[model samples]
Target chain A: MKQTPRIASLPPAFGSWRDIRPLVAVVSARYRTLLQYRAAAFAGFATQLFWGAIRLMILAAFFAAATEPQPMNLTEVVAYVWLGQALLGMLPWNVDADFRQQIRDGTVAYDLLRPLDLYSYWYGRTLGFRVAAPTLRGIPMVLFAMVLLPLAGLGDWALIPPASAVAFAGFVGSLVLAAMLATAVTLLAHISLLWTISGVGVDRILTVLVTIFSGLVVPLPLFPDWLQPFLNWQPFRGLADVPYRIYSGNIPPAEIVPELVFILVWTVALVLLGRLILLRGVRRMVVQGG
Target chain B: MPQIEVRGLAKTFRVAERLPGLAGAFRGLFHRRMRDVHALDGIDFDIERGELVGYIGPNGAGKSTTIKILAGILNPTSGTCRVDGLTPWRDRRRHVSRIGVVFGQRTQLWWDLPVIESFDLLRDIYRVPPATYRDNRDRLIALMDLEPLLDVPVRQLSLGQRMRSDLAAALLHGPSLLFLDEPTIGLDAVSKLAIRDFVRELNRDRQVTVLLTTHDMDDIEALCDRVMVIGNGRILADGSVDGLRRRVRNERVLVVDYDSASEAAMLAAEGEGVRLVERDASRVRIAFDPERLPAATLIGKLLAQGTPHDLFIEHPPIEQTVAELYAEHDMRER
Candidate 1:
């Protein structure tokens, strides 16, 4: 007699991956959706470039005062600011208001039914956006920064490749770490919905804190010595400022290896914490107003 | 062994009780009160493989809670439940792989993507084999007549079209068990009929185990071979549709029109549990138990007594029957 394999006998781990598949599915869908609005995407890219040029002009003026014949130079300042802004755009910030909206709108009911861990789904989706951000925001900024840098007469193009590779790896790792921490924070905040009617204020405050402390607006080295210690230890620094330092060569290659190791450690810790928070939050879900 | 087994399934929710009005709302922020709600209390049932069961209940009667527990969305406070030999809450990922759930209020379809794109995504989600997926996808699309709507974005689809697409998407994985929660809640008559017919065919032809919860009696009457009624955190009744109907089978109504009240000779038909309502000089309505007096004999006796114009017999409406049963069990006040 011939018999087909029973589903029960199949590996259980296969089921977990099957559920995670939708995360990729959703990202691909989002990409196709963004393609339909390519004109808007390009317009966004142009706006980012304009902003980068403004920041470069100010940094160049500062460089003129600092040293004879440009101390920091145009290329370094422009590339540094350009990558910083692009990395800022790619960092994990989707959970700021999205989780609150989902809880309020009752759409979260569908999300709960999915077989995959909800946090992983959000992580994978954020990865897609980060990948997409480089194309839409980073590439254009790099081109504009290159064009604007010749005033300093210092194009050390040879330093670009290794620096870019290290920076890319660090940025991706940092984004993963940021996303994990952000997801965990949001999960805890989302549980507040059970206690509070709204989480908008809390969400806004968290975003503002991330922007200020993560060195997205200003460089971390510019902060006071006392605050520098705090930034180095916190997960936010790895998410944004640490990667920006590597990209601008503020931190040498010898310094980056340890930073990468630290970022990896933060990523693993935050993901585990996020999973635990999600487990606790789901058990306490009140399912308001059907 | 039963394909689905539930023993003493109970779920209690701690709901934050909010006071009404502006002043109360302000006070609630500082000092809040929580009330425990027993959504499901001691529910037990067994469904064999290939059984099409209708789980009907009134609003907040734990219909959704039971469905969620069985689908592995929420864990019960206590008790045991297994779907296809796996504890749903413990082995959720693996258990869910064998089941397909469709919430009519929600769309599993990607709103911005075309219907076919959503199907492709689900194929990846369930990890359906390429060949098996092709066969199933083609068959479902054809069965649901979704070829014309394939390329249209889900946001542009009508409720009927989207529902048809949702059904197709859920089935792409070829799950052995299917959970449909209010699958026909707010559909036009045509769409409702299409959904009901497809569900019937899915159960009958595919031998799939179906557990459907609905407020619509027609959905219950049309699809389910066995029906379970839930009320106030408990299973009120579980039986075949005929058996449920028999539970509250006391009243039979008959409408009769006569030539004239005087010619009907006082129209004093009494005894053997008959209550006459409305003597409008021409027509008379009687309520009685058909078991005690057969309709044919009663009508013949009525005709012998008076010259009739028309007569019709009707069993009580399903809603009234259920309401009465609920009241009998003291489920309405609670």
Candidate 2:
């Protein structure tokens, strides 16, 4: 019998980006998806602007009520609040929910069969969002804030170019911490579903805690005396408060070391916890007859 | 060399038991019950390179559990599986690159993107080189007839269209081993035949190894050279389709149009192990196992004994054979 030649050869190593080729492909696809709905993107940007204006109005009221003449130095406060809101929009909540949804919907089966590492895939996609979401809303919010303030104060804005650079790194750290914590929490919640049909209770509790403790609405520093100590030590504070404080210069660079260490600790701890839950939970997955 | 090997594969799951009613629900908030479900139990098989095997089983009979384990999704409780000398679960990332899997009910394609976009994303996901990706994608698109669906969003495609796209997607990376689980479910007859024809060509021409699990028996009859029946997480039978047919029953039906209905009834009574299944005014059909009495022998006997107008003999469909096998093993519940 004659020999049959193989048409295609396997990749040298699995899940390794052989070249810049595949990464570019994944980024391009994600970009095209976000651009597909023009109206939705516009509406999202408009919502950010509307909320930024409302926050600036509240700060303006505080300046008006001040007793000292320049007690009303509202420029820095307005810029900070606007930038904080924009940064808040950039952070992602693991949607701890997709974990349960994927398992329930059988989509996890499809994802696992793919060659790429699940962790790497999620990280790439979330990084893509970090880039896309911030640019879409952040740039406009800054532009709007610039129009409302004077070019004189914009002199201090020279600090912004470097400040933004430092802010970007700190922002990324915040997203990673949030994603890892949510993933860990989601894994914990999802494991319970192996025994219970409903994961609603756990899901609601997680969302509520992340929202209040992560400082999405109010700054952690603004919390009452009784709550400040508890919020300071929790992982939620590291996600939003630590990063924002670093960005606004509320905590000087010299003080960032401790916050960075805390965030790193949380990331490592949550990753270990997520992996443990997955290893243990999978053994109990009982896909019933369909 | 055997490309795929399995020995004593077993999997078990601990299921939580919930109480019923308002009182039971409130009482069970603190305490919960647990139960164990055995999915796959001691399954063993070996397939050589490029062998197309059909794995058939009733629902929850471990067909999917075996597939999931082989695909590296779920770790088995005990036992082992190796494909291309790599344990699937232990080294999943490397193992998955060389194999392609398509689940009939799910689409790997992203719903919001066009078919081409999802393919591009998968190229990145598998890290396929651009030159190779272009060539392989073009070949699959042509072979699977997906030229028209490439620009369309996956959500908008018809079930038949999506399945065709999925098949092309699975082959885009040019994997040597392919696992197709219920690939033809809910497809129209024309689409089913097209898919079967394409898979047959892929196996015969490209030598891609295939392990298919399907509820549709026609798929097995049309494509598979060997069939493995699994029940209660165990391999019940493994052999050629013809061998399976013999085990169930080789019953062939003889339909006779007789000059008189009475003569047909009289001839049917005279024959042993031949019973009349249905009859009209001038036509009668009788079922008899071909092994007990050969088709030619039975026909000759019937013709010699009765004055019939026309007669023909045909075997029962494969569905009946599989049903009988399941019934014999008491595996119908699964």
Candidate 3:
């Protein structure tokens, strides 16, 4: 039998390039794992499409019965609803069962023993999950709706490209920022499991809050005037409502920059807050057995 | 300096006391009660380099807590612990990078990925250079006889196979100190022996300091030269296995299979200080304190009664000795 060489006597000082490998490895691993569940992603897209049609019919009926001029035209409303359906996968409504299981089983100790920063490690995974799910489900759902709606003689209501190249670029940028913000928010819920010790309550609360406030249930403009300002000011709206509005050209050219800035601020704040909570939670976990 | 040193280490967990029913649970929401559970208290030990130490105790004896503290996964409530001259919890990343830990009940491998993929991922996670990782991975695979299982997903592995993979995974980084917590639990006899042999060889060849926590007495007797017996959050005994047995009792048991059932009863009443501890027809187990009566004298007395069919004298099994130790110290609660 061959003799095994001893481990390197000296610990290598990690260069910046080496430090990034673990993060990239975490993200790619999670993305690959997500890809393995392609059937589920397709099922999720189909569910969203089904709900989108029901929502569009309701909006159409309301538009026909309206007594006053609506803020959004019929074509814009259809586009908004389709965008909401496509972006449904971007909502951070689902709880991470694996993280909760790790906490409960005390196996989370292994995670702590790793040399990497725990928050960033989990953040990379969450980012991968957020992007992978949307890429697999959302983009396909948007394409399907774009083709189907026009073929079914709803040509005026088919998905519209952003008004200009700058607007299109801004829409993509906002979507990426929205995904980041959503991941950070979802991570906060997962970390809250350290205190709750169970995911059900947190999962339910986040689901309800995200459903009502994220404008996935209904576009923010359709809400009563009194509620629109409050919904727009909240961070949940930035997840789906702001990005979809930007994509559908619902937000005017002048307002796009401020809306994108609002999203940027929220993303930065949530990321920082998530990092803080994760550190405190990890300390608590180390002190009290995981 | 000792490779591992712990002094007056303690840990206390503040656990919420929840009420039983829905109403009580609701009542607890407003004014919840918290109680402190002291998992470890004043734990102290020093293990030199290349020492293979067996850490044994009943359930909830704080063995796992102590290992967790030393592994840099948990913070101690008080006192101090140092491994390889670094405070584990304080210098966590650096400390952990030098130590390998395996919890038999849980795996560190990616569940859905192939064993080789998880190994590759661990290499990246630990930032091992490609050449070093390849050499180390190949050596471990060969040593563990795991070449056949590398392509199999971890979820598809049997417990024994998974354990072999886990042992290899923990050693891939070439840690100087290894903590094996119940490493041989739930393995077939063959698998158990294989792991024991591998661990023994690793300790011998690599000079890796090993602190093994296990319930298996055979494992302790086979691999450990020094044993630490913990009970009720304290070290009850720490010495050689013989010393531990001596602390409990100095009795040797003699089982005689006589020529006839009649001779068994006649021999049972013959020797002084020799009590009939157990008897089944012609076979009889005689217990005698070795200090009171030597084995030779006791055997002479038994042979005078009759020439027995067969007889042998040996110290009681380590399980009974350790159990007696636990009962004597009132640490048998767990």
Candidate 4:
């Protein structure tokens, strides 16, 4: 029989390119696996197309009937609504389903056994999940809304390009920040399962929050005056509202740096809170199943 | 110094007690009750390096809890545990890097990934050296006969095949210490023997220290030189297999097939340390301590009573011995 060779020495704790290798490996593997589900991506694109058309019709009617001036013009709202549809998959609306099942069955012990930080490992997985869906469907949605609708003579309801070249660049920066912020929230939901075990309540609450507050349903600038301040300061805005507005010039290029700062602050805060919560959870985590 | 040392190890969990019925559940939604369950009640033990120790116990007997704590997967309520001079929970990353764990009922492999891909994921996760990983991968695949199953998703493999793959996955990092929680549970005879032989070889040839928790007596008898029996969160006995048997029971049995039932029952062969254990129509089982009355002497006395008979001496099975130990402990508790 061949002998199993022993490890000559242990890997160092937390520095060097080696520490980041696992994160890249896990994220890429998950990205590859999730992208294979092309049918789900197509279904999502079809569903979002249906919803976007309905919302655009309603917004066009609302703008036509209005006597008072709107915060965003009809053209801008058209762009905002189309942008929401294209990027709908980027919202952090639920915990990782496979991880939730692992928690229920006590297989999470295997995760704990690995010589990696739980928070970072989960963050890598969430990052991969957050990006894959959009990579598959978002481009097609953009092409359909921006090019095909205008070609079909519905130019008024088409997704216009970014307000300017600078706006486009700002949108790109904010979009990357948006993915990081979204992963932080999703990673928190994953850690919350260590306490709740079942994520049903969290999922329902998060869906409502992400859909409404992230400007996925209605543009933040059009909200009533009283709710505008609350909606503006909240962290969910970074997920969809920040990037959409940056793309539409609702948040001007000059103001984009401060908005990006806002997102970085929230991401840092949530990640620290997640790490602390995970530490406590692992300490108190009585393995549930046999 | 010992490879593993645990002192005053205890764990308690506060479980929510929900009332039964719809009405009670509604009431429970407003008013909740809590109860504390003592999963591990102050146990202590020490194991030397390169020792293959069997930790056996009944269900919910703190066996899994101990393994979890030692593997750095759980933090005990109050205790001090050191694995290779490092505190498990406090220094979990450093501690876990040196040890491997396998749970029979739960897989460590990724559910959706192919076996080989999962292995590759682990290679990066542990930051294994490329040459070392390649060697171990090929060796384990050959050793476990996993070449055919390497491309299959984990969920598609049979239970036995998955168990073999899980074992290989656990050893990929070449951990010198292993904690196996019922590694052969729900396995066929061939798989069981295969796991046992591999574990024995790992411990003996590589000088790996192993702590195995199992309900299978054959697993204990075949692989371990030392057995630790735990019950009600306490170590009841810890020593050699023969030592445990001596602690619980040391009786030898004599089976006599007589010509008639009446003759078998009426043959009151007077002797000390001898009693009837079981009786059929014409076959009688007599229990006697071989130390007090030799098997040959007991057979002689039984044969004098019935000449037309066949007789044989038998030692009790290990299962019977272990069950009796549990029963004896339960009786004492009552």
Identify the candidate with maximal DockQ.
Answer: 4
Write the residue-wise lDDT of candidate 2 on B1-334 in tens digits.
6999999998877777778999888877888888888888798999999889999989989988888888887778788788999988777779989999988988878776999889988888788888999999999999888888899999999999999999989988999999999999999999999999999999999999999999999999999999999998899999988889887886778888888868766765346767778877788888887767777887788777767889887668888998989999898664
Cα lDDT tens digits, model 3, B172-278, are 88898999999999999999998999999999999988999999999999999999999889999999998988888878888889878887777645456778788
List, residue by residue over B219-325, the lDDT tens digit for candidate 1.
Answer: 88888889999999989889988778788777778888777777555667787868886666777778877788878878878877767878898767777777777
Tens-digit lDDT string for candidate 3 (A1-290): 11122233312221235567887787777777677787998898889888888998898899999999977778778877888777776789876667788878878768877777677778777777777777788788778778876888977667776667767887888888888788888888888888887889988898889988988777778889988768878999888777777776778778888988998888778776776676678777788868
In what order do the candidates fall by DockQ, top score first? 4, 3, 2, 1
Candidate ranking under TM-score, highest first, comes to: 4, 3, 1, 2
Kindly report the docking quality category of candidate 2.
acceptable
| lDDT per residue as tens, model 4, A20-137 | 8999888877787788788999999999999999998888888889999988888889888888888887889988788798888767766778898777777788888888888898
lDDT of 2: 0.72
Q: Which candidate number maximizes lDDT?
A: 4
What is the RMSD of candidate 4?
A: 5.9
Which parts of model 2 are misplaced by more than 4 Å?
Answer: A1-40, A64-73, A93-100, A129-132, A148-290, B258-269, B302-310
- B1-334: candidate 4 lDDT, tens digit per residue: 9999999998877778988899889998898898888878899999999999999888988898899889877778887989999988777789988898888988888877899999999999988999999999999999899999999989899999999999999989899999999999999999999999999988989999999999899999999999998888888889998888877899887888888888877877556899888788888888898889888777777667667468887767778888898998892321
Worst 10-residue lDDT window for candidate 4 chain B reads B325-334
Where does model 1 exceed 4 Å of error?
A1-23, A33-43, A67-74, A94-98, A147-199, A221-234, A240-256, A286-290, B19-30, B253-288, B299-313, B329-334
Residue B76 local lDDT, model 1: 80
- DockQ of every predicted complex: 0.27, 0.32, 0.33, 0.34
